[model samples]
Target: MITVTSRSELTQSDSAPDPTAEPQDGTVLFEGRHHHSGVTFFWADTPPGSGPETHWHPYTETWAVIEGDVEISADGETLQAATGDIVTVTAGTVHRFWNTGAENLRMLCIHASPELIEHEVPQD
Candidate 1:
């Protein structure tokens, strides 16, 4: 089976409540479950200086930058990514992302397992 979805369709769907507001510093535009592959697509928007703290997950992830720029850090290394760039994070690797650019950063993140949801950072 094949399913097609667009940004416009997601914006208008009542079932997919706004995941954006749930995040403190940024917005999660959309997230969908893929039954066949047991994967999920999470789309989000991050304003400058907004991003999650370092954390690790059991599932692999791939993030594609759709707009603006972001600073991606993993395993003590950091790199800047612009539009059209993609970053991959293997399972169990520590990673984080920050939007340092002036405009809002848009990204599409894909996760290999639905069980890998999200893990929050602990405040020290």
Candidate 2:
């Protein structure tokens, strides 16, 4: 059978990348296990010069750029991606991204795991 999750339901029960971090302007997280799925979704309209720090996952993660541009740093290399681009980082790879465009960087972060499992690297 097919199921549907309304937009209101998503807003009512979404998670942030950092539980301790303050609410951001346009960030949303959808943990799919709550809906019987095997993946997690993290979407954001991150403004320029802003982004998450380095992080790693036990499972592969992918990012589909719906709008704007981004500079992704993965495994010691920097990759540039623009609208309509899709990038994937393998499991156990250290990666992070920043909004390099003048507008908000809109993208979908798809995690392969049923739940969100991430480890953020501490900056010096």
Candidate 3:
């Protein structure tokens, strides 16, 4: 099956900048179940120091960095990724990322689930 969803139709954001909030630039999330798909996706082009907080899902997740740089912390391990790089976090691994570049960081977040099922890491 083929499904097409535009930025206008997608307002929810799983990361820092909200595309709907700024219009020209930012991030937007496409929850799979909402669009009759089998995977949740995030198109992110947020400003420096902007990104999602620590969180996890029951399914595996991957991030493809298309531009800028990113620093990721997953399961107590720190990783760095730049343009043309891809990183994956296994299921149930607590992870978060930050835009570690001077410019906006663009990336694609893909979740291996039909719905966006996320869980927060407990705070101290």
Candidate 4:
């Protein structure tokens, strides 16, 4: 079966930039309901200095950095990744990522599950 979803159809999460808010920092794009068979793919592009907040998933997620640079923080330690790099986060691992380069960061996020399930880390 084939399914197509546009970025606008995605449900906006608190971690994503609010277009209604001034000085938007970044954005998050999620796959639609059709993602529930085997695997799911979502696209994300963050301007420099912006990205998703800390969160964890019950299923594994892999990120393919298509452009610019990103800094990934997993379980505590952080590492810098650039274009052509692929970052993988195992299931239930707390993590977050940010665009640290001077340009907009583009990435393809592949999820082992068909649907998106996220548990955000609470702020102190």
Which candidate number would show the highest lDDT if scored against the true structure?
A: 2
The 10-residue segment of model 3 with minimum total lDDT is: 14-23
Off by over 4 Å in 3: 12-25
Give candidate 4's root-mean-square deviation (CA, Å): 3.7
Q: By lDDT, is 3 or 4 better?
A: 3
Kindly list the per-residue Cα lDDT of model 3 for residues 56-105, writing each as its tens digit: 89999988999999999988899889999989899989999999999999
Q: In terms of TM-score, how similar is model 4 to the real structure? A: 0.77
Judging by lDDT, tell me the better candidate of 1 and 2. 2
On the 0 to 100 scale, the lDDT of residue 13 in model 4 is: 45
- TM-score, candidate 2, is 0.91
lDDT of 1 by residue, 3-85 (tens): 77655564433122333444453443344443344666657677888887777778899999999889998888999999999
* lDDT score, candidate 1, position 14: 17
Ranking the candidates on lDDT from highest down gives 2, 3, 4, 1
Candidate 1 displacement at residue 113 in angstroms: 1.3
Clashing pairs in 2: none
| Candidate 2 residue spans exceeding 4 A from truth | 11-13
What do the candidate models score in CA lDDT, each in turn? 0.71, 0.87, 0.82, 0.76
| Residues 1-124 of candidate 4: C-alpha lDDT, one tens digit per residue | 7666556665554223343544353445454444435666657777888877798999999999999899999999899989999999999999999989999999888878766687999967
Task: Give the TM-score ranking, best first.
Answer: 2, 3, 4, 1
Which regions of candidate 1 deviate over 4 angstroms? 4-21, 24-26, 29-37, 121-124
